[model samples]
Target: MLKSTTPTMVEAGTKTKKKHRTFSLNAKDKYYALLFLGPSLLILSVFVFYPMLRTLYISMFLTNTLGKTTVFNGLGNYTDLLGSPEYIASLGSTLVYVFAVTILTVGIGLLLANLASKRLPGIGVFRTLYSVTMGVSVSVAAIFWLFIFNPSTGFFALLSNMVGLPVINWLTDPTMAMWAVIITTVWMNLGFTFLILLGAISSVPTTLYEAASIEGASERRQFFKITVPMISPTLFFVSTITLIEGFKSFGLIDLITKGGPTNSTNMLVYRIYKDAFYSGNYAQASSEAIILTVIIAFFTFLQFKFLEKRVNY
Candidate 1:
């Protein structure tokens, strides 16, 4: 009996040691996890989080041209912006620009993706051309299009001359300026959107199309029924990203129009830039920046709340 009890005691001791070892390993794993995540967290804290919080704080106070806080204004900056007709007009232009860019970019991207998805000969060349713009910088694209939209010695001017048509004012006219900026933005963004949608379409299983064909579905039917539903998740993702990008667009507006022609193409981001840098109105710029952030956040929330439900996956 004594020998048997001794063996039982030894066995219980070993079991306790095993538990202790497992707990130690788990604690070390947690430490390693935090170690790996530390760099990323530090970067975000320094860049993204700090800047956002600082902007919010600055927006509540009046600031001089040098960005030094002069007085505590509470919500005065926000109220002033909301009341200003210029701000209102800028907001309206932003809405129109965002919607137009999002729609046209995604639409054209989808069309190009579908076309490139075909198995025709030399399709690789077309695919390469479709995605080439993704590598072009915003400034380069803007300058390239500047020549295209130039009233004199530009592509459109030459085309008009050859066709015996009037040379349209592409960038000077108020209405045309907004559309010109939108077109430039769409063209610049098309490559990215096309690549994303192309990947999404490529990931869709071919078996679905085969099944649809067996059921006598036409090409259009297969596209709508099989392809669309299958790739709905990616479509939703691309749409959300494109929408946010449209809201934050600045480069093309800066280089192409500079929010000009009666402020017709004045987007919110460009408005923030002009206020902060050009006009030296730091308080107003901070407030406008905060407003833009809130608007983007609100739209993103709406998309996730309503649109995400439609995503198949």
Candidate 2:
């Protein structure tokens, strides 16, 4: 005898609960996603976009030893920089560095990742120690390598005596300095790159490995066929990043090698910096920076167009 409830009321309550449930997803997932994404977005906005805009704006003028001046030079700065021998040589050197670093980082990173994926004892400790170098700034790492390669008072000098070899001026010599830089960069960066590859490799479903094993696939064959294809996207990503960083290398060139014994190590980024700060020709430096930006942009585009297309499903 209590009361006759309308079906509409019950149906409305049911619909509301259903809507709420449909939209919900274990709040933990949402929180974790935001936690992971927030840091990366902040970094990109602060470090990448802000400086990019400022650099582009500063490139459109003329300045010299007379005083600070902006003469509305249009594309004249770009034309002159492209035509100059110094700029051309720097561009060539920059390309070489990009290739060297990319190849080294990717090759070594993938190899280390493969080894680490085996779940060996103490792998966690080894991984942490390997990545510790990445915490150091590039300038600091460059200086460390400078000391290590020093002729008279360096680790190499002591090692040379162990083998009865004469002391070699690795940093002061034009030929060896760039190699030293590359080795240092590779050693410092490999750990993080390796971690990326290791994660990518692990995400490959265990079923795939079992299937490969069932088919009598050797370990090398399984790696080449399954692991590589699955992890290709990560590899491409790391290589592209390393390439861009190589082009922008200046701290090491300035702090460690000083782009000497001649202009051998004078990367484009260092040239841009020297022109702006040392020579007081901000316009020229900006112009050079623009050129570097364009070059990097072109490579970035190619990477997205070709490499990104190959990302694994």
Backbone clashes per model, in order? 0, 0
Taken over the whole model, the C-alpha lDDT of each candidate is 0.90, 0.81
What would the per-residue lDDT of candidate 1 be over residues 1-313, giving only the tens digit for each residue?
A: 1334697897786687675643344667679878998899999999999999999999999998677999999999999999999999999999999999988998999989999998899999999999999999999999999999999889999999999999989999999999999999899889999999999899888998888899999999988887788778778888889899999999899999999988998889999999899988898999999999899999998988887777775
Best by lDDT: 1
Considering only N, C-alpha and C atoms within 3 Å, which residue pairs clash in candidate 2?
none
Candidate 1 off by > 4 Å: 1-34
Task: Provide the global lDDT of candidate 1 against the true structure.
Answer: 0.90
- Indicate the residue-level lDDT of 254 in model 1: 93
Give per-model TM-scores.
0.88, 0.78
